[model samples]
Target: MLSGVGACPAVSAAEADTTDNAALNDANTTIIVTGLKPDEGQNKISQSGALGAKTLFDTPYSISVIDAEDITRRQANSIGQIFANDPSVFSSAPSGSTNWWGTQIRGLGVRNYYIDDVPLLLYWGGDFPLEPIESVTALKGLTGFMYGFGAPGGVISYRTKRPTAEAMLTTEIGYRTSSVFYARADAGGPLSQDGRLGYRVNIGGEKGNAYNQAGINRLVGSLALEYAISPDLKWYATATYEDSNLQHEPFQFYWANYVGNSLPRPTYDYEKLNVANSYYKARTLAAATGLDWTFARGWSARLTYGYTNKYHRSNKMFVYMRNQAGDYDGYAYNFAELDQNHFGQAMIQGDVMTGPIRHQIVTGASFQQTDSAFGYNDRDYYWGNDFNGNIYQDQPFRVTRAIRFGTGGWPSKEQQRALFLSDTLHLGEHVQAMVGARHTRYRLADLDGNPLVDSGYRTSAVTPTLALIYKPAPYASLYGSYVEAMEPGSRVGGEYANVGEVLKATLSRQYEIGAKYEHRQFSLTLAGFRIERANTIDRLINGARHLTQDGLTLYKGVEAIGSYRFSDRLKLGAGVLHLGPSIRNVSAGNEDLRGNIPAGAAKWQLTGSAEYYVAAIPGLSLHGNLRHSGKAPTSDSNTLYVPAYTTANLGFQFNTLIGGRKVTFTGNVNNLLNAKYWTQTNIGEGINAAMSVRLSL
Candidate 1:
């Protein structure tokens, strides 16, 4: 990892210069592994959430890592796109609205995001940015013990690229369909002798009409710097900013509220669904400072403080042309919102041996708070008009503008405090066990930011994790683990007599068993898991009605992941996931839905990618990838479905020495077949493509 005399809390700084190291044992250090060559084999993930740097084979949980080098070559435009191809992840393309950042892992919504294991809350930001990020680590099960209170689905951890030991500069330019263009520059290096100080910075912007009238106007930048106070201590800070003005691009169905034949999915040239004048814009700024202290004799501490602020406004509009007539008014709404979040954490770790058993332990405390406000105004432009003309026929219609916003006030306020402890026990040469627990104090307030009742509804819960592992050979590892997570209860107000009362935190659990095999330059992982949670309902107890938690919503699945480096010129990767979800012991009202497939969920998903360098072209290669999702139920009623879909992509890359500098040019044609499909509640689709050039200095 990046350090002076020992492993610092951060990863390594020379990630860009390593290419011949293919061994996983030495790959745990921080460096965005860019899988650009066959020798570049190790794509190590961040072990912060796991308490130590363990390779994928050494870790007890199912996690996946794909570094930035892999991402840039894949033509992924957003962080979600980079991970969406994994079958285990359920991703929806952003409509550039409040729900843009939504992602579901293991059948549950995942909201907790981390940078180097530190928590961050994006209360109102429509999207989770991919800018300035160098690598990504995704935890695929309950993570309450690893982070704190959050969805049971898991956590997405991001690591920013550290300053390179050698100074260099890189610039990239790209263009896509719909008249969009972008440019970015990256530079980093040490600023003092013995590398006592270093810095890395990234700045970029994109503009013009992009993908279906979303009309993009975006800017992103970040600066990260670190200073070594001594051989045993260091200080680091980063400031990041992003701003965007995006036109609202609504999905055609808006199906959650209106399903079945009565509300037919609309179809128009996918490009026409976006109103030229409708828009959603937002800006976010965040800064964080941290300390990494390493004491003599296996003891160290890591701490960080962070602050984030965001503001956004939108004039959201959606057009449905399936049933249409003369120009009728379209639905529109205006909203303005703001959010602020403060986060902090302090952790200490130590290594010691008890007799023949060795122990590695970590203890930490965390705090997070968020305050937000929002308001909206609604209007119907078609309210005064009849059918003007059909939009699909290219009949131009006047775009309405609304500049007024309703008064806004704080609608929500939340705070959480937590203390956690974890230990890894080494019992023998081939056996190890991990145990951990977290105690959390959490509370929520009403819109007025006041307690629901007297002092407000406050509660606490304890979550734990246990795991055992065995490694019979250097190349193989097997493990089984059980973990539980919690989510704050649904809060209600004044209408009820017990208004101030708060339901206990809902508990969710997961049990998993997995095996990992690493031989030569290939890696494979196979696992099976089951997840469950209980639902609370009113029941008669002693002739009196009381809320009782019972019944189970269960999700079970099996998954396989593998990657191979066949030769100096060939590389390939693939994954498969399947889930079976059902509700058992449901209440009378939901009895009929028992065993029914859940809504917006695909039973099967698969992804694969390959790259082959051509011996004949000297510096040329072809790359292709495919993604598939099985048909999914559109709603809880199971009366309608979103058909199964597959998307194919093909691209090519050419690399060569240009004036003593290396330059790579690449391009891809996404949705190459233009197959119409629904990404969610939408029903219009089209062909998309992007091309870019990168020059290294």
Candidate 2:
């Protein structure tokens, strides 16, 4: 059973400011907490973290904070691995035949990724690296009301380490199976005599191999600078670069008729068959600068600008064996493709306070452009009679030589412009309200100078959100919200019949209600939400064309999370999630996709973690985690399924003094039992175990 800490009396509206002042004075003696502090009293309710920082424990939302200590304890090498312990979140290979992992939240896709307070639009196509991050925050549910133009799924914000007043240096090296190697170094301090100016730099690289014989290699680096021009104005800039070379494995699917069957299947030599003959290369660079100013009274303003460029190329080879007279021989089917993109954005935000009402406002405009070019070259080879005979006997064969060339053209470009505004109002001591809206226009252009069918075609949409928060006391709060969102449609394959027709944006609506409770040693939250979408895109039975008019989908679910401290040296965390059935409606002529559970939507999920201090040995601790995911349908048909599975992990940490200097050592064993299970039955792939060690100074 969980017990809640009683709430404190709500401060009167007239005395709220006085109460804040007193709280601020009391905090002066306490240690400053980084990345969790509130901005100011006037910005409290409307601000993202404005609510009492410590009171986050009381919020009724599915939230997880991967703090610095967790980062070290888990030996996390990338952002994708950081949330592996969270039951609701799942990581899988990208569908585009790449090595990158697509992290999903509550069965919905995450579209936007943020660094610090700025948004990074280039999360896809394997652009950014997870190194150089100090911590990551995962917020579930509709946060569009706070961040603007985000997925209903959730948002991940990564906060990078900044130069501290004190100088520091750190480095690490590690190795794993398949000759994998990892190395990283970071250093920073004041660049000038005055602490007002500072600079920090980071560099890292990795090379490794996967269980399937695929190779991975990448290099990552970043630089940041901060300057305080005066007491009221400040500026900061950050830049990052990443390059990766990866070998990809093709997906395999089994026949639906084969279920719970045991047979000694023939194992083909993957290397000999060259079944996974594909390689991808990508490079990305991005930079951002921000200016902040404080005015007289309780007025402040901020402006930020960012730009990114990404390039990718891939080569794939297909192999097939044909039986002629008697022997087996190999034939090759190959293709090569390339893609490039450039993105830029700018935003301005401000806040102000009036007599009894405090208003937090964010108004900004942004533009993004993406250009891609794809042309494939193919080859075909034939084996002689000798090899054909081997094939007849079910013997392995290899492609001696072949030559073939094929050509197809795919050149496309897209442009988008958007503007958004939001305001949060404090009605009184116990109630707060927030309302916001956004407008966006999108355009797609053809490769030739001539206008594409949908060229110059424009669609505009307005999304609004409303929220009410009632905090009767300091330790508990209840909230409910209604939000509207939309996803733009692409003009691919000339699907839109009315090229000149102005189409409205596809729209989605979400309704949510939840409550939060917090105590000195425990916290809990329970939330329920429903989401509906219209004009969802779908394909015909033949899969030759797409129909824009036949798309509709609905998703609803309940999520609950809690954390409790059992003792001064022990703690526990747990969560449970249940998603309702998803439904789709379409014309009868189309594929039979009605009454099917949504792909990737699990019915039940659970996660729990425990931590304990080793009283017998000082400075030693142990941690363990367990995760379970329920069965899920593979596709719209819902005929095929992937059975549920659970995994466990264990680790240990120790703190000691080396030459009178503080140091920490950590080790972890992921997949403690080394279980073999398929996450996606349709995709036919599985993840193996990993062991890692790390030292921090």
Candidate whose TM-score is highest: 1
Candidate 1: stretches off by over 4 Å: 1-45, 50-53, 94-101, 123-126, 257-268, 318-330, 376-401, 404-407, 450-455, 490-504, 534-551
| Tens digits of lDDT, candidate 2, 1-697 | 1111111211111112110111222211212111112321111222232121223433334555564446656665544456655656665542223523256677765665666555555433422475666557666655644454445667776666666565666565655444567787777778889889987788888787654445668899988888899988889888878887766443222222223322112222223322344456667666778777775455555666666555554443322222112122332233323333344444445556788887756566666665654342223221123222221133233333443322234455666667777676777777768776766666666543244354554556677777777888665678887877665553332222332222345667888888776645566667788877653444444544343555566778887766766665676878887888566676665457776676667888887878776666655678888878787775555755666767777877655445433344566666666544445421322233344433233
Per-residue accuracy of model 1 over 1-697 as CA lDDT, tens digit each: 1100011111122123222121222322223222322212222434655355555555677876656765676667654456645678766553333444456676655677776555656533425456677777678878878776776777777777667666767788998777889998888888998898998888888887655656778999998898999989999988778898876464324343332333333343645455556677878777788998998689888888888777776565543333323122345445566767788888888889999998878888888887666552242111122123344444344455446543353356778899989888988889989998999898775546445543366778898989998989766788999988887774332222343345657888999999876656566778899998765444445664344445676889988867676765566778788889765777776676677765666788888867676766655667777888787775545766667788777888666556656566878777677766665544433567789998777
Query: What C-alpha lDDT do the candidate models reach, one value each?
Result: 0.65, 0.54
Cα TM-score of candidate 1: 0.85
Residue pairs that clash (backbone atoms under 3 angstroms), model 1: 2-11, 11-30, 12-30, 326-387, 326-388, 326-389, 327-387, 327-388, 327-389, 329-382
- Clashes (candidate 1): 10
Question: How many clashes in each structure?
Answer: 10, 12
Candidate 2 weakest ten by summed lDDT? 13-22
Q: Which stretches of candidate 2 lie over 4 Å from their true place?
A: 1-63, 78-80, 94-101, 116-127, 141-152, 248-277, 316-355, 373-409, 445-454, 491-504, 535-549, 590-592, 681-697
